[model samples]
Target: MVGIVKYNMAKISGKVVSVLAKRGPGSGGTYPGHIFTKIGGQESISKLASDLKIGSVLITGTNGKTTTTTLLIKLMSNDIQIRKSYENNILNSIATALLTQKGDMGIFEYGIRNLTYGIPDTVQKLIDPIGVVYTTISQEHTQVAGIKNPFEDYYKAKKLLSEGMQRGAIVTNADDPRTALIGLNKASDVNINYYGIEVDNVEDIGGEDIECPKCGQPLSYSKHFLNHRGVYTCQCGFKRPEPDVKLVNAEFNTDSWKLTIEGDLFNYTTSQNVKFNVVLSVPPFGFHNIYNTLASITAYATFTPKVENIESTVKEIFNNLDMSFIPPGRFEVVDIGGKYVGLGQGDNGDAIKINAMFMNQFVDGPLEFIYTTPDENEEEIFNDHFEVVKSMNPAHVIVVPGRKSIEKAKEYYEIIKKEYPDAEFYPLSYDEMGVRIEKLTELARDSDYDYVIMTGCGEEQAMWEEIKKKMINR
Candidate 1:
């Protein structure tokens, strides 16, 4: 009884913080939750979460979590009120949303790098979410906070997020074996809704080999839709799960894409079967966003209380959708006075490949690749990134340090020099991020090549987005 009183007092104090935090940047998003946790403790989080009458849903994965969460929030918001948060993927962000937002449901994007940094199990227990959405998972951060985080441990950390759930639904990507395995393993404990692409028109021409999550042997892909995500089977008898929600057809154009998506999934709120088939016309947001579209739609169908409003709401939101829906610092192509430049964050191999694919569509002739090198202990990421650079067949390559380690960046550049003997290297210090951003922007802007693609490993907002803003506003 005393604990309840204390929690109420903490909630009131958190609310006051939320109301008075000046509402700028991270302060409004996470400070309230931090104060609440400091005063009422971590145990109080569950009580705050319980305020949602329909419970919460968390989106997590290597990529696409923010985009998927944003789309899901839009879809669900049309049907019912929802408390939501994204970009800042920590618990405090969600806690702040809970304190300030009034809604029946809570939607938050949660990112897990590894077990030590991300407490997935504890979050699952505290939030007690009714739905946990998994975007495609792949290797990105090989090391977290100077610790070597193996792929096995990273995969385990993602699994722990939904492993303890006894009710609700698991919305996952059927095309990605890692996420499919998670849904398959949890089929007995909860409702599993898988989303994927079924059309052959969209296929990845080349990609790296992926190991089967179930078996140690290499998995065989019948079709590759995106990097490490495709229709595949293993010797251990594990294969891609049939998608409950899928993109049955897609019509790609220069400006927009037409997607025919179908969904038949169990709604956790209404406890009934719901289905919808709708063709949405959306901005040419890239192939990765196709998965994001399916993920958000599947999750919305799985949790929305208004089942009958599914088709209308989806069409309403997506048909009129714009490129603005994409989160900041993601890949986007811009025209700078007749020069076509594609620039944004491509921190991981998978992400870099996608950015390349997107930029390929706009490359007419003589493309210059402005590459950013990863930091120390990230040789694996460098190797994957180098593969992408070679595939792009740029007329020129410029390498700069994307992270703090200028020495490691030099090492990576030397290897590139072997293949492209003319490749130039700039040992940009991480301390002077402003100078780095300026040089990167200048290289892409003043380049002789009409087609330029600036992407690799870099801070999403601070580096890439800033450079993009400078080039656009120049």
Candidate 2:
């Protein structure tokens, strides 16, 4: 119910708002997109996107969407006019793409929250992505997925991305049994490309209990990597698909790692001899990112045309990249007056578990844990994460209240007290940013604590900014 000229005007206004918002106080990332969605709606946005010549590439999953999207953008050839939005919001993504429309290709990270209805209603109809990458599936978004039987709801919701994908290529992780099944179910209709990490002595641990999609039977795994992801087999004849793109013979070190990526398409060996100057949330850099790296490389390889030697092609594509680049807030490490502090921003319980275990490993001595959540509904997830953090036997633990909910803070405190009676608990309350920085600074000053590790499901960016600002001043 909108005219072309009106839509254009709305888009311009949205961009202006975005620019103004960015220059002002807060991150203007999602505001412009929100304005565009509110004013123009999906119909106008879709009409505007119809002019895209190169098609779109959608990246969506529980974790690694931003990192994967960023890597994919870097791996892709420069000539492709790829439009991407860092915002995970659907409206923001649509607006950003329409405003910045260029090149033949569009790359977007569609958040998992929008999978059920957002994909079918907006992305499928608008971007009509020729290619899609699903990073991994975990039970997240409890409110959206419903409280009871949330896993099934989350799984089905995530599958909507593939179902809505334009019959081109859908790349997924082979080790992630849930997403692998989603790809297999669609293999008959779509080009399902699978990629995963292949390593020896990979134990199945700390993953959701995976069940067969076909039958409600429990799945078995020879090697479970993280959570339910591994070489899974079911009695209903569902099994993990062999990856078309695989990173084999992977090895990790304290400062560096090595990868030998092999598949039907490409055979390449790459090593991180020089530490990338950042500590990833998944430490040793091989735990989770290896999968993300393989997925990105494999997805890009498929997107690119037939190359007889994918190894050379990969080297050529990524040769110019700053290998030192770190995705913001994943596992961001900062020095606050010579004290090494790391931030592990987990998006879900599994992510929390993964990062907690890694952070526990990489720390030299006496690690301090700071935990925060933004929503009360995430208490169950918080409990799961707190259990993992507790298992790490941190030197001290700080339970910060959620953004606006003190009640949830109290609940989190109870969980900590009930589980770890003797563990040190600091229920410090900071109402202002300055107060938070001051309190955290005081804690860092203590030589007793080796390093402070902050883990938050939400409110990571705000905390990360505060910590960075403190470091800058120090």
Candidate 3:
């Protein structure tokens, strides 16, 4: 029941997304709206508070919230209406929401620390009066949350989502077992809209093949899209959602992706999952970008038909259509002194793990690899993740010596050395490392394969700043 003048609407994902393509002031054109109103909710909120202007959508979860929020806001913006801001994290979410409604509908992205982990009550209250977007429940930022058991912490965060917000607010992501278990209860009064990846595609390194949230049987994947998402069917006969809209037969082309509605099969790509093909998350960056793109876009498509021109519109939004990575980190190549250096970070953050979640796309290649371990600042690196790095058997790993470097970083390298004995170890201070890094980057810029990455660096923030400065001068 969101207040709508019903000026005009468009079709997307066939029939997904709606609402105001533009709102507030200064908002000119329209894109797709992913929110739906029952017809009375608007009045209800208005009655709840005359101050009630537009409800916000807080897309929070352990992973993909930022990227997903970015994509949703981007797709949600067409010629005129657009998302306001992309804040640093959940702590700043509310602040971003207040900036400029100017007639444009508000779509806020919130980040939660495990559950009730980092944010104070006031921030929680902010979400209370907004639209709810639960990205997914997974293990992340446990130290700050004080929940070593990531699942429980993540699950608790999901439950906490219901404290604020109206009845039956738009909620998606049926694939998350924790979602149905916790969110279903908190949002009991709210209408439920569910979307999941392929059931059989469940690769429960820790999060899939879960019992039916309702029926308690092994869920079957009607088709696994990507990650823990796809169509699901329970023995009790509840299927992943008929999906008024589906991201069928998603196709990823390394740098970009394409998606289509289900019925367009014979005319489109041969994948049976036609309705769910691959499309860039918005700006359409690299492979990792695809993960967040699918979730939010699919759900948005469900409620709003404004996403039809998504592929075409994305090009316009990206401004610079290059899938640029945050350089000196994650697949970075540089030219220093005419020598090529491939640089990348092997941070143990959970998002990097794509064993089952990512296949060929997350390849350990580019010919040469120069691994570097950073000083741990706050987040500690778990041993298991480093073991995977060792398994890669790169040419060399340089553990930077610094006060901020993680205590265990060197220890983990010790672990890798046991497996990769010949792996040259150059324990250099930041000054020498910086100069050497320059030389590597210079070569990487020139040669086909010179520099690769400085894996497992905890002091990356400090390093990235220095690198940025060097690039500017160069």
| Candidate 2 deviant stretches above 4 angstroms | 1-41, 77-79, 114-121, 144-149, 201-208, 265-286, 305-313, 316-324, 334-339, 373-375, 422-434, 444-447
lDDT scores in order: 0.91, 0.65, 0.44
Candidate 1 per-residue lDDT, tens place, 1-474, comes to 229878988989998988887664422589899899888999899988988999999999999999999999999989888898899889998898888888999999999999999999999999999999999888886889888889889999999999999999999999999999999999999999999999989989895569998887999999999998999999999999999999999999988889999888888889998878999999998899999999999999999999999999999999989888878888899999999999999888999999999999899899999999888999999999999999999999999888888889999999999999999999988899888888888999999999999998888888887988899897
| Rank list by lDDT | 1, 2, 3
Measured over all alpha carbons after superposition, the RMSD of each candidate to the real structure, in angstroms, is: 1.2, 5.8, 10.8
For residues 1-474, could you state the per-residue lDDT of candidate 3 as single tens digits? 443342111122102322333332212111222121132222222322223243445566655665577666666656336344443454332332332234234565655665445542344453343446666665443344233535455565555665554542545565555454444555456555444443232233332355665656788864544334445677776665443233344455555545443211110111122233333332324434444544555434432333355445544444333434232233343445544343444444444343212322343543333444534432344453554454444454444433234344466457667766755454545556666556544433443533344334434445544553564356
Residue 410, candidate 3: alpha-carbon lDDT: 66
Taking all chains together, each candidate's TM-score versus the true structure is: 0.98, 0.82, 0.62
What's the true lDDT of residue 430 in model 1?
A: 88
